[model samples]
Target: MSFSPDRSQASEAAPVTGSAPGSASGAFAIATQGLSKRFGNRTAVDGLTIGIPAGTIAGFVGPNGAGKTTTIRLLLGLVRPNAGSATILGHPLTASPSYLPRVGALIEAPAFYPSLSGRTNLEVLARLGGYPTSRVSELLEVVELSDRARDRVGTYSLGMKQRLGVAMALLPDPDLLILDEPANGLDPLGIIGIRDLLRRVREQGKTILLSSHLLGELEQVTDWLIMLHQGKALTCGSTRDLLAQRGELVVEAGDAMQLDLVARIVSEADYVVTREDRTLHIACPATFAETLNRQAREAGATNLTIRVKEASLEQLFLALVKGDRS
Candidate 1:
C-alpha cells in the first residue's frame, strides 16, 4: 500500500540522521538507540535500535520470548529501560507527559465493567480522562459498536470486546496509536474487521505501531517492519524491500528422476536448489522462473511446472532467526 501521512495532523518530526535497511527517508514517529531492559539476569531487550517513520503503520514482529512486549512497555513508559534512550513525537523519553497525551495504546487484553453498556463505558472513560463525551458516539460508530452500544459488556463477544478496547484507546484522538495483539482470540472475520479498522484509522493521518504474531495479516497492512529475536532487532525497515531480498522458483516434475534432472539444471546454473520429493526449490529471484522452465525442458525433463514464490514474513523471520543462531 501507499503511505502518505497528513503532516498537518502529525507532530513536527525530527530530521532523519540515519536509515534502517529499506526504510523510507523521513522523520521518525518513534526512534530508539541502545534501548535495553532486564528483569533479574534475563535480558528482555538488548541494545535495540530502531526507527518507525512518521505516518506509517509499522509492524512489531517477534516470536515468543523475543522481547516484543518489553519493547512496547519501554516505549509506553510502563517500564523504564536499563540503558539507552528514545524519542516519541520529538519529545525525549524522560518527558513522557509531553508526548503521552498525543499517544493512545491498547496493550494486551482490555478491561471494562461487565455490567455497563459499551457506550456508557466509553462515556465514563471520556469523562474521567477530561475528554468531551461527544466523542463517545463517533468512536462507537468507528469501531462498529454503535449497533451494540446499548448492550452490556457482559454480553459482548471476544471480538466485540476487542473493538471496544480499540475505541477506548482512541478516545483521546491520539496522533500515534499502539496496539498489541488486537486480533488475539479473534476469529478470521474478526481479524479482518480489525485490519479494516486499522486502515480507516490510518486514513486520518495517524501513525500506528502494531505488535502481533499474525505475520500474514501484518504483511498485508504494514508499510514498515521491525523484526525481533532474543531481545534484539534482527531487521528493521521497509516490508517490501526486506521481502524482495529473497524469492524462489518451485519446479515440479511428474517423476523423481525428472525432478533430479531439473534440480541439476538449476544447480548447474549456480542457483541454490533444495529437493523435496518431486519438487525442486531453487533459491533465486522470481524473474528467473522463465529461464528455469526453459532450462529444465532443455534438460529432457518433461511435464515440468515452475512457479515463482515471494518470501513471506514467516519465511523471512525463520531464515533470519536461524541465521542469527548459526
Candidate 2:
C-alpha cells in the first residue's frame, strides 16, 4: 500500500534525525512541530511533535485524557494552536486551500439527519457539495450499507451508524482519512469489518490516522504506533521495534502443582510469573533464561518447556509509564 503526498515548497516529509519514526511509511501525511495547546491554567497538549506517514495505518494510542482528541481537533483546524505549526499534505493546515475535498474525517461519533434515509442523506450531501451523483451508490456498497441504503439513520444501531459514517467519509474519495475512536460503537465483527475496510483503503493509496483505546485489536492492524502520556509523546515507532519486550525464560516442568513448586523455588528469578492453564510465563534478562532452565532441571523436573515470550504492546506501555524504573 502506498500514498503519494503533494510536494510542498518546503518538505514536511523529512525525518526528524534526532527522533525516531512515528510511522513505518516513508513519507509523512501529517507533521507537527512543538505544537501545544492550553486551556487557561490547564495544558492539554504540550510541545507535541508527531509525524504520521502517508498511507500507513498509524495508531495514535494513549490512555484516556491524554490529549488525543485535542491534537486531532487542532490538526483539523477545529481548534487554533497555542504554539508551533502543523501541515497536511504539503500545505500549512491553517492555509488549507480548497483541498478539503481530498480529505475525509470522522471525528468522534458521526452525526447524520435522523429522519432521512441513508441513501437519501448521502444523495442530498452529494448534490449540495458538488459531488457527482454517481458516487453515492459506490460508497454505499463500499461500507456494506447498500442493502440498507433506504433505512432511516435514527433506526440504525450504533454499529450500523458507524458503518454509515465511514460510508459518508468515503463518499468524497479522499486521499487521507482521519478517524477518532472509529471503533467506539462497533461490535467485534463490525470492528473487524472496519479494520479490513481501512486496510483496503490503504491498498488503494489512502492514508489513515486512527486514534483508539483498543490497543490489543489495533496492534493486529496498525503498522506503527504513537503513545501519549500526560499530554506528551512517550514513544512512537514501528510496532515490532517499539513494543518488543524481551526477557529471561522461565522453564517449568510437570503438572500444575509442580509448576507451583517451581514458582516457590525460583522465587528470586527476577521476573513476574505469567500463568496459563498448565504453563507459566515470566520476563527476565537474556542472561537468566539459561540459568533458570538448568535450575528447573536440577529441581527434579522431567517435563519442561522453556522459551522467551516477547512482551505485548500493553505490557510495554505499562512498563514505560508505571515500571519501577523505565
Report each candidate's C-alpha RMSD, comma-separated, in the order given. 7.6, 9.2
Residue pairs with backbone atoms closer than 3 Å in model 2 (clashes): 248-284
Per-candidate TM equals: 0.80, 0.75
Q: Write the per-residue lDDT of candidate 1 for residues 1-326, one digit (tens) a residue.
A: 11121111111222221233224323889988889999999999999888998889999888878898899899899999999988888788899999999999999999999999999999999998998899999999999999999999999999999999999999999999999988899999999999889999999999999998878989988988888888888888777656654567777678888888877777787878988887778776455666666776777776877765677889888887787321
Evaluated against the true structure, the overall lDDT of model 1 is: 0.82
Best by TM-score: 1
Worst 10 residues of 1 by lDDT: 1-10
Residue 251's lDDT in candidate 1: 73
Candidate 1 local Cα displacement, residue 65, angstroms: 2.1
What shift in Å separates residue 20 of candidate 2 from its native position after superposition?
5.8
Writing each residue's lDDT as its tens digit, candidate 2 over 1-326 gives 11111111111122232133445323778777778899998888988877777778888888888888998888888888899887787668787654466888888899889999999988888887788879898888878889988999899888778888887777778888888998996889989988987888889888888888888877878877787777777766566445433333445566876677667655775567767777676664434455565676677664676655445777777776773332
Q: Report the Cα lDDT for residue 317, model 2.
A: 73
Count of backbone collisions in candidate 2: 1
Candidate 2 lowest-lDDT run of ten: 1-10
